[model samples]
Target: MDVDTRHWIGGRRVANADTFEDVSPLDGEVIAVVSRGGTAEVDAAVAAAKDAFVGWSRTSPAERAELLRRVAAGIEARIEDLAQVETRDNGSLLRSHRRGVMPRVAMNIRFFADHLSSLVHSDFDTRGHRNHVTWDPAGVTAIVTPWNAPLMLATWRIGPALAAGNTVVAKPPEWAPLTASLFADIAHEAGLPAGVFNVVQGLGNEAGAPLVAHPDVRRICFTGSVPTSIKVGESAARNVTPVSFELGGKSPLLVFDDADLDLAVDLAVEQFDNSGQVCLAAVRMLVQDGIYDEFRARFLERAATLVQGDSRDEGVDLGPLVSKSHFERVDGFVKRAVAGGAEVILGGGPNDELNVATGGFYYRPTVFEGVDRTMEITCQEVFGPVLTLQGFSTEDDGIAMANDTDYGLAATIVTGSQERAERVASAVRAGTVWVNCFFVRDLSAPFGGSGRSGIGREGGTWSFDFYCDVKNSVFAPKGWN
Candidate 1:
């Protein structure tokens, strides 16, 4: 927890006039103070990246793969420290962070290292003539990553963008910029060239906006809320720069009568894993009418038993919501749900275990019954440890309730029969559907949304296609020419 007001530009850290403090969501503690960058630092980062793009983009794919391999090694070596920092900064549970954060980030790095060269060198031939398609990096990329899953999300964008030969100006959330600073040092050890990858620290209006709006930036990859995605999309449009966004979700989880009650309950907690901050967290639970009461009983039993406390506490399964503002926002939604006639089935209070004088954004993992599809809690994205429960009498009704919301980022259908699982999974409108399991993701599987959830996809080996353009090269016989 150090306060250093500087940014990585042209391969090294540089100072800025203004500063911002990074506060720990666990205890509302000032963990670090990062310097805010203005037009000068953003321009410098862009210029440096443009300068580096020439050689970096021209480097062989094998060489790029080797660099990515080293970056993976550096991250592996410091996995413990990185996981702890992510938990502290994002208020994710320590155990979950360790399990979910490290392995995934390393896997992304390794996945790209192993497959990027092949993806880049892959060629296509059509009609007995040579027609080739190559993947090239977009020249200067502005990566605007969210505070949630800082390192991992950055790797998702930066890894592929860099692997394809783009130089980058990565801007992490201003609330947790220090981790990206740490990551930059890790990259330095990984042998990335000066300006090949840079981290600029500042707020969206100052640093993020300029970076996105910069004329030299050819592409953008962002992960955050929908409103911000719209802004980034607008900037990209004005500049004619292609952009990718991994945005918000009001995902659903369906439980059928045949599902194992124990398993369904466990997955219910997983839906709120990280206190339900994940973009694709299963915020809505749709249970078949036959088992609605039983499912509710089991869900409340498990949810009531969960331990919510400081990230530093042992056996703490859930931590605080990000900050006071986030806490207020989530709490406000819960209040609205209650006012709208949803019954609080379980857990509706603040945790008193942590420092109470200055409450860290802590709230009980809440569940609501009597939820109608039209209610705000059921229809909107309540990015908190809050789950709204709705009962459906038939299979079609279950699907109808699951797809009721405008957001369709992800959903889960639990059933003992494969036919039923597939049937419901097909009917549910979402980018990802978990069959009998919830929140389980494969790095090689496509991840995105179906509706207002998001615009672009991430994850999977072939995900680079969403971020790059494809062109066909044709050859004719010399005699014909």
Candidate 2:
């Protein structure tokens, strides 16, 4: 796997002496030696973006749209290689990358490209005068993406930022830095002008802090934990720079007694999608007391059947926990839960024998049966394949228990009654609430969180609103003055 793992600045791979190991969670192997950036690298990348912003911001929406289409094509052409390296880099299932992740990268770019072309501003006549409102491109945008589905999330922010005619400097997660280098290559090859999109690869403090705090950066977009987002917000505030964050969650999934049991059970299993490394997955499940016993029985049976091993395996459903430290963190949460009297119905921790056999950072798909809202496993955002269950006697109790958490990112509702579905969806304190299915995404819809989960919404017009400055110019009528 010989590849150019360096900072991408000014349409090329820039070199740096400070480097870090891109370790594989699959088997704890050093996949690549990547350049670790600092304040100097951040300054250089920001300067490059600042230089390109002047020209890029003045381009027509049609021009920006066409270039983005080319970027989407570049991703589609090399989707398989991109998917493979991503699986190798961060321990996500290869099947998911091929099926969803890489394809969505292309989709994210194409959707925003088309959106830019169709975008329309507003104009009105008021008091014998004409007022025209326009979406003006903000200058340089600083984007810091998380490791889980790194490329897809980056493009989710990147597509709109570029479509709105803003230049970008991104700090891809150091845990999975490979694909971002490849993404910058795709952007450059797609005829994106030099410095329009730059990459500074390093840790949160070394590179990420400097990029977000850079005085020249106009807007900041970040996706990761809530604690980190607070620091970002604080840094961005010093310059009064606007920031958009999509942070962590311990979102709830409400299952009513009237719900279809089979569908309910399957949805519970789907929480482990991407090995439960998903932020929106409902790890905290609150079930109506009527169906609690049956749902728990069926859920544990299905959870036990899930295969955990090599992410490259076609039959596997779960993989390693992304890193040794992350594995430890998730395991620590479970240990505390067990210590506090929460019964682990399935998967307390990793199987040491199997872990030694594969040399992979693996954890069993865990479910806690007796966890209350006070338990760490029930309230905290365990970004691993962990589930916590509690029973509620009535609809009010279920919704109340669901909203008890500090996070309000997303939620899932399961019920057979239409009235109940509508009422519960409205009552649930989350940004996005799913009534029946899970992970069904619409590109045009506003996507983000509430409370400690996130700061703003993005997707389609919402993205444009955040990435661009909406301005209005008023003029007197020809004879009015």
Candidate 3:
């Protein structure tokens, strides 16, 4: 297949000899071809960012915030176009991406922009003392985003970094570079300085590693898998460069005996939104034995009711996996779970009925029954719309089971008692615990994982602290000195 080599560099589309194909998962069709960048592309992007950083980082915070506001406007203006492209590119349901994801992300950008405009730096009132603490830019950041929710997560990192006066050489996943390019274009149109935000498109081994390890690159903000995050950590360690990783999760949903079974079932189904591709999605559903069967039956009924169809189709609740490899991996996990003796309580296997003429990569929304905490299906971050339902004998057992995973990204607890919700939420051992909902994220909330899930937070005002550094100066006043 002939591939197009259009790479986003310094806010413009450039071409090169190398290329990669953008394949559609809806029918395994070649949608477009993207440039496969290499060391040269990485070096160019970094050099541009480094050259621009001196001036861009020195820009007034209000000016930076204004630029972000314009970018947000640009995004809103092209929301439909972006939503359609994202749906076609990633197999995300168009309605969900438009109604749920894009609007939320755009709102986040505006929220942060307004916050940045209103921000006032600390004042030193130490009786004429020169000693004070100051926050400073960390230079250029390498913002690497995953293929899943490419634009939203990228802006989550880039927005704060820019707001903190850090220029960026952003690199989207080669497999999904168009959205990154679109964002960069929007930023440029918003009157951002030339070279302030550079984007590179290429594979991880070639473009991504070099960008992370580049001496001029100050901090690396990455959102991807835990294993890949470790590799990034290794590279960052070698250079002593700071890194903030938003990685994997096997998040759990714990339903207490006194919980509203109907609402629990509703929230449990929400866990599978976006086909459970989110890193913070609740993949494990743990119910107290008293209500396990009831919750299980309700949850499966809800799951079965999901309308699996093309993303562009109206009223389609689910869509195909992001790619062929993703489909295969998800299929493998479901098959392996059955092989490992977990019973399929509801929908399982592939869905050819949704798009019979088209070879859509659709996996049936699956639920595994009789799952134990130690089972692979329960412990692994499957990253699919597959939930493993397990029953716990006691509240303590439920909490223990929820916390048993290596991940501590997010967890959900369903209970009517405020005290029980608070206690269980606190004891769940996850970074963010939803008392009665699942995946309710906000701009002001600090979002990140603990343990093996991830390294740093990515939202709210707290995220700004992650992209910059603070220096404390201790000294007496001139008279005292």
| 1-481: candidate 3 lDDT, tens digit per residue | 2222466566566778887888777887878778788889988888888888898778877888888888889889888877887787788889877787787667767877776754445656566655565556788899899988898888887778888888888878765667777777677778888878888888899889898888888899988888888888998998899889888899888888899988998888887787778787888888898987788778887888988878898888888888878889998989888998899987778786754667778888888887776678888888888988888898888888888888898888899999998788888888888888766677887888899988877676576677778766766656542
Question: Candidate 1 versus the native: TM-score?
Answer: 0.95
- lDDT (tens digit, per residue) of candidate 2 on 88-153: 999999999998999999999999999986578667889978899888999899999999899999
Query: Model 1 over residues 1-481: C-alpha lDDT tens digits?
Result: 4424478888888987688887888889888778888788899999999999999989988898899889988988888888888787888777766776877787777786677745644555667667777665668989999877788888887778887788889998876666688778888878999999988888899889888989999988888888888888888899899877777788878888898888888888887777878887887888888888888887887777787787766788788888787888988998888888889987765566554854588888888988787788877777888887888888888888788888888887778889998888888898888887766777677887767777767765556675456556877535472
Least accurate 10 contiguous residues by lDDT in model 1: 117-126
Ranking by TM-score: 2, 1, 3
Stretches of candidate 3 above 4 Å error?
1-5, 117-131, 479-481
RMSD of 1: 1.9
Using Cα atoms with residue i matched to residue i, what is each candidate's TM-score against the true structure? 0.95, 0.98, 0.95
TM-score of 3: 0.95
* CA RMSD per model (angstroms): 1.9, 1.1, 2.4
Off by over 4 Å in 1: 1-5, 120-128, 352-358, 479-481
The residue ranges of model 2 lying beyond 4 angstroms of the native Cα positions read 479-481
lDDT of 2 at 102: 98
Better of 2 and 3 by TM-score: 2
